[model samples]
Structure formats: C-alpha cells, structure tokens
Target: MANHKSALKRARQSEEKRMRNRTVKTRIKNVVKEVRSAVAEGAKDTAAQDLNKAKSIIAKAAKKGVIHRKTASRKISRLAKHVNTLTA
Candidate 1:
C-alpha cells in the first residue's frame, strides 16, 4: 500500500496507465497476428495490406511509449521481408 497521499495518487495513476498500455499492446499484437496469418496463408497482397496497417499501429504505439521504437521497426522490417520473399 502507498502510505503517503501523493504515493497513493501516484499508484492510482500508474494503475490506470498500465491498463491503458495493456489495451494498446493487445491491439498491436492482434494486428501483428493478422499480418502474420495473412502471410502464412500465402496471401501476399492481403498480408502487405495488413502489414501496412499493423506497422502504422505499431509506430503509433511506439511513439506513445507503449512499445520500443526498434521493436516496431524490426516487426515492420520482418513482415516486409516475409512478404517480399513470397512475392519474389
């Protein structure tokens, strides 16, 4: 328990932030999964489209500090590479 009043307020704020962050992270994962499944199903065009959407969501999440920038970049790069190999 947070003993001080300020500490209690901080704890409350932290919990709210954690819940919000979790939702954003969950959305990011779902989008990424959509892209991955599209790729796995051998639908390059669909995968590409989904990747674009997922990338944007990831970038937004990263910008908001919900996820690391490098992680977002890496995910986009990897998905792009997979789609490339399929089309190539």
Candidate 2:
C-alpha cells in the first residue's frame, strides 16, 4: 500500500494509463495479425487493405507512446514487404 497521498494518487493514475495503453497495444496486435493472416492466405486485396489499417494503427500507437516509433516503423516495413511479395 502507498503511504503517501501523492503516491496513492499516482498509483491510480498509473492504473488508468495501463488500461488505456493495453487496449491500444491489443488493437495494434490484432490489426497486425489480420494483415499477416490475409497475406498468408494469399489474399492480395485483403492483405493490402489490412496492411494499410495496421500501418495506421501502429503509427497511432507510436504517437500515443504505446509502442516505440522505430518499432512501429519496422513492423510497417516488414508487413509491407510480405504483402508486396504476395502481389508480385
């Protein structure tokens, strides 16, 4: 238990932030998975659409501090490559 009042308040704030961050993180993962699955199934149109969606979600997550900017960029790059391979 936090002894100081400020510490307790901070703990509450941290909990709120954690839940928000977790939701963003989960959304990003789900979008990425959707892209991957579409690519794996050789659905070029669906994969492209999903990849764009995942890229947007990842960029948003990075902006929100839920994920690192470099991490998001790398993921976008890799997914784009995979989707491109399916098209080409």
Candidate 3:
C-alpha cells in the first residue's frame, strides 16, 4: 500500500527491476545447465562453447548487480573445472 505518489512510482520501478532480474537469473541457470549436460554427454567442444556463454552471462549479471562478483567468479571457476575434468 504505497499512499505517496513517489512511493507508488518507486514500487512500480521495483517490480520492473525484479522481473528483469528474474529473467537474467533464469537465463544464467539455463546456460549453466546446458554446459553441464554437454559435459555429461562427453561433448567437449560444445561444453566449452556453452561454458564461454555461461561465463559471459554470469559476469554480466554480476556487473548488473543481480549477483555478487565473487559468486560469479566462483561459478565460472567451478564450471571451468568441470569442463576441464571432462577433457582430462
């Protein structure tokens, strides 16, 4: 219940931001899953490609303030490690 006009405007902006963030988060999840599946299927090239895409998306999310920088770095690291394991 935002009575003040400014408050109502802020609420609307918040909702819009929330929806945008959610979409970004969902995209991140899907990219990560795609990478994992490629790795599981032993498709090293596809996995590497997907990992690159995932890293970019995650870094962008961090830069946009949707996720923390360390979290993004950690995710990229872990995904890289998994992809490497598939090669080795």
Candidate 4:
C-alpha cells in the first residue's frame, strides 16, 4: 500500500519494469536454449546463426540493464565456443 502519490507512481513503475525484465530474461533463456539445441543437433550453420542472434539479444539486454555486461559477455563467449566446437 503506497501512501503517497509519488510512492504509488514508483510502485507502478517498479512493477512495469519487473515485468519487462522478466520478459527479457525469458527471451534470453529461450535464445540460449535454441543455440544449445542447435549445437546438440550437430547443425553447425543453424547453431552459428542462433549464436549470433543470441549475442545480439544478450548485448541489448545488458545495454538495457536487464543483465550485467560481464554476464552477457560470458554468455556470448560460451555460445561462440559451442558454435566453434561444432565447426571444428
């Protein structure tokens, strides 16, 4: 229960941000899963494509403050490694 008007506005903003962040996080997870599944299926081309898409999504999430920059970099690195391994 927000007593002040400003507090109520803040609460609303927080809830909106939370929902947006949740969606972004879910999207990130789904993209990562897609990349992993492609790799597991031995589809190097598909995996690489998915990795690129994932990298972009992760970077945007980091830029938007949904996730940490280092975390995004780590995710991109790992996905790239998997794609590379598939190619190699």
Every candidate's lDDT: 0.90, 0.92, 0.97, 0.95
Give stretches of model 4 more than 4 Å off. Answer: none
What is the C-alpha lDDT profile of model 4 across 1-88, one tens digit per residue?
Answer: 9999999999999999999999999999999999999999999889988988999999999999999999999999988988899867
After the best TM-score superposition of candidate 4, give how far the Cα of residue 74 lies from its true spot, in angstroms.
Answer: 0.7
Which stretches of candidate 2 lie above 4 Å from their native place? none
- In model 4, the number of clashes is 0
TM-score attained by model 3: 0.96
Per-residue accuracy of model 2 over 22-85 as CA lDDT, tens digit each? 9999998899899999988999999989988998999999998889999999999999998999
What is candidate 1's lDDT per residue for 1-88, written digit by digit as tens? 9999999999999999999999999998899889889988999889989988988999999999998999989988987887787788
Query: Lowest summed-lDDT stretch of 10 residues in model 1?
Result: 79-88
Give the runs in model 3 whose Cα sits over 4 Å from its true position: none
Candidate that beats the other on lDDT, 2 or 4, i.e. the better one: 4
The local lDDT score (0 to 100) that residue 86 gets in candidate 4 is 81
Clashing pairs in 3: none
lDDT of 1 at 54: 87
List the candidate numbers ranked by TM-score, top first.
3, 2, 4, 1
Lowest lDDT 10-residue stretch of candidate 3: 79-88
